[model samples]
Target: GVTAITAVSPAISARQEDTAVAVANVVMFGTLAMLAYPYLAHHILAADSHRIGMFLGLAVHDTSQAIGSALTYSNVYSDEVVLKVAAITKLSRNLCLAAVVPWLTYLNVRAETKDDEGKEEELEGKKSAGGKSVLAYVPPFVAGVCAMAVL
Candidate 1:
């Protein structure tokens, strides 16, 4: 998710430093989540397979870490259901990335448009005097993702 955000950062006019900070934060927290979530599910929550899976899926930031935690939990507890549920839940969350990036870009463009006070100027391709389409604001990778989804 952070990687996708960083890829679209240029289209959204995000600062490099901000993207760097975001990557750093995700790496730090994602590692911690990977290490901590299994223990939390097994010991702290004392939850069943379904609940443990849901907890890990929702709590962890990255898909790999979430699945890893689930695998760890399942291996320790000898429950395959936990791994399955966690994979499904985490994948469902991952799908949200397709919508989130464009929505954030739209919001950023809208704010910039408001700041421009109706001036006919380009702001990150959201608007342009050259009459560029709204697609101008979409990052190429996002279009590729949509294409892959269609396929």
Candidate 2:
């Protein structure tokens, strides 16, 4: 959820209202996941610390929430493996953000640009004037993300 908001916000070309609603949904669902994951791990996934950890790491929307859920589960069940596994899994998932964010941003920008182009063609009967280059559509933060991923 935090990744969605932080990584996607700058690349989003949607109206502020739409972005706000999306952010709100992310936060709401993430909160719910944080609250519910521990109990689900305990009852539904009994005696499987690794599965519980993987489920929490993959299912939770935020890194902190995943780790917190694992910690809560650990304390409740008196098992420390869940915490270790969850942290590793969550951090591994987080590393993908560098690649995923830029790709998602590019796709979003391309889709919006295509829609705009089609609309302009219908109205003007020609290619849009002063159209942005492909390079221009690339988000600025992509380079930094790639650099950090390399490091």
Candidate 3:
């Protein structure tokens, strides 16, 4: 997420750092989601062991925290499947990050160059950077994600 924001940081006009900080904000929510889900599961959903594992796996963003919490849950409930589900779900979220690059790059590029479209520059001499190559915005970490996924 830091990498994703860094990839687009150069293009944003207003709230430039906010774009980067948004990633951390999202991760904060992931942590909150992780902490909140267990209570939600027990009191609200009345979840069983498998669902609890899956809920946590889907909710938590940090792997170590998820694994640690899963271990706690496993010990608390005497079920190992909770740990497995958490690991799988966290991995699944990381895998999806691999596929998000192209679209995110496109959005960043679009936001950067929202104006000066379809004009041959009859008025002002300024031009939007709408023609930036998509490849230019792809972060190096995305390659690591691809390699990890491949391996």
Candidate 4:
């Protein structure tokens, strides 16, 4: 997963750990995303019995994990509904990447201006076009992310 991120996020080339941090954050988010799924599912599916999809989708970061977990759930407690729910919910969580990039871009813009001490550090390499306006170079990946957002 980290290997694949290099192609999408050119900024990751500046620091290898960026890739690790990005992937790890999303995977961890996937785990956390499941936190409310059970409660919601119990209320929504109070009469219906299938919930494997909710569990698999909430816990999984990748399709393989979703499929594997759903398969296991199927053998133990669920049916075809497990696969359907898992696919939809996992995909919903995965789409967060589209939203996350915009927020990171906002933080990046903010960081260019101030630091932890609230002092405006001298920018070493890329100077601002004007003393007042901060310049931003939005990468092609962001265009794709925007397109995903539009969809």
In model 1, residue pairs whose N, Cα or C atoms come closer than 3 Å (at least 3 residues apart or on different chains), thus clashing, are: none
Query: Mind giving the per-residue lDDT tens digits that candidate 2 earns over 6-93?
Result: 6666555557787788777867887888888889777898769999988888898778888888888899889999999988888777
lDDT by residue for model 3 (41-96), tens: 65554647677787776656566666666776777667788778877877777667
Clashing pairs in 2: none
Which of the numbered candidates is closest to the native, going by highest TM-score? Answer: 1
Query: After superposition, which runs of candidate 3 have C-alpha atoms over 4 Å from their true positions?
Result: 1-16, 19-36, 39-47, 114-132
Task: Please give each candidate's TM-score.
Answer: 0.77, 0.71, 0.65, 0.51
Q: What is the C-alpha RMSD of each candidate to the true structure, in Å?
A: 3.5, 5.0, 5.3, 7.2
Off by over 4 Å in 2: 112-151
Q: What is the C-alpha RMSD, rounded to one decimal, of candidate 1?
A: 3.5
**Positional deviation of residue 55's Cα in model 2 after best superposition, in angstroms:** 0.6
Quality of model 4 by C-alpha lDDT: 0.55
Return whichever of 2 and 3 wins on lDDT.
Answer: 2
Model 4 agreement with the true structure over 1-151: per-residue lDDT tens digits: 2323543454222466777788787666644544444444445666253454766676665555565555555555546677677777866665665555445544555566686798776655554323432224335564675577678
31-149: candidate 1 lDDT, tens digit per residue = 88888789877877676888898988888877788889899888888989989999989877766666877777666666555534665344554563334544666666666666775
lDDT of each: 0.75, 0.72, 0.63, 0.55
Model 3 Cα shift for residue 105 (angstroms) = 0.5
List, in order, the clash count of every candidate structure. Answer: 0, 0, 0, 0
Error of 2 at 114 (Å): 3.9
